[model samples]
Target: MTIRVLLADDQALLRATFRILIDSCDDMEVVAEATGGAEAVALARVHRPDLVLMDIRMPGTDGLAATTAICADPELSGTRVLILTPSEIDAHVAQALQAGASGFLGKDVTADALLDGIRTVAAGDSLLSPLATRVLITRFLSAPAQGAPPRASEDLGALTAREREVTAWVAEGHSNEEIGERLFVSPLTVRTHVHRAMTKLGARDRAQLVVIAYQSGLAQASRPAQR
Candidate 1:
């Protein structure tokens, strides 16, 4: 199936460049374009594209607010947002993830990497790697929301013991392969456990799973300061 994409960037030149690259792919196509964040949210509601390629610094509304709006909309549940920015600043990454963005990509990413990210987020997985993902979780998503403490362990009651273990490993920045190797299970098994945990916790994807793992206190280890 073709992946429908909505391009949201203030620069017409960049939008055009992305459109050319996306449309050139057989499995992807640009369905719409937006010049600003508000327009992006509006077009998203109207088009309901599979993915929105969003830039953080738009003229108005901004990508973070737009992402929150889109993700919070019941009608747009099937739509996913991917933040494309010039830097992988941890603060922005954390904010975007908290706002329900499915993935983040630096603008310096190669065309192939960008296309892969679009596909990854479109397929209900996040684009963050294990290490970067860990730092994001440790530094931002793990923090208490509204100055409250992490949710009680009972909050993760829906996940099985094994699922919780897998989630903790994930929050620690282990990939499926790494987790499998550590647990003596196959990568596919690890993926299944992760997916099951995601389903039980009502997580949107792996990034959200990591967020929940930390926020719920299932993974509490801290990491060194990120550069």
Candidate 2:
């Protein structure tokens, strides 16, 4: 299946460049383009593309707010957002993920990496494997925003024991294959459990599941052991 993409960037040159690159891919197609955040939100609602290539900074609504709006809309729940930014600032990454972005990529990424990221996010997976991303999620996303009202997490009682285990593994940044190996199950089985967890938790995607796992303290972040 061809993955439909909506490009949202403030720079016309960058958008055109991305359009050319994405259109060259056989499995992906650019369905729409938005120059600002509000326009991105509106286009996403209208096109309901499989993914939106969102820029972090934009005029007016901005990428973070646009991501929130798109993700919050039940009609556009199936659409995923992949944040594209020039910098890998921890605070911005946390906010982007919180706003429902499935992945974050630097503008300096190679064409192949960018395409792979689009495909990865479109396939219901998150591209947060980089160490910086891990640290950002661990340190920032786990804590409640300052001065923000305390919020209650969704009940995890709806998930079975195995599903909870799978979610924790996911939050810890384990891929399906890695989780399957740990659990002595097939990758497909692990994926099934992940999907079940997401459904029960009402998560938009695997990224949201990870966010919830960390925010709810069901999983704790620790530094990766030295290789």
Clashing pairs in 2: none
Query: Candidate 2: lDDT over CA atoms?
Result: 0.84
Worst 10 residues of 2 by lDDT: 218-227
Which candidate has the highest TM-score of all? 1
Error of 2 at 156 (Å): 1.6
lDDT of each: 0.86, 0.84
Off by over 4 Å in 1: 147-150, 221-227
lDDT of 2 by residue, 21-113 (tens): 999999999999999999999999889999999998898889999998998898997899999987765587787887788988988999999
Kindly give the stretch of ten consecutive residues in candidate 1 with the minimal lDDT sum: 218-227
**Model 1 lDDT, full chain set:** 0.86
- Over 4 Å off in model 2, which ranges? 130-133, 146-154, 221-227
- Report RMSD for candidate 1: 3.4
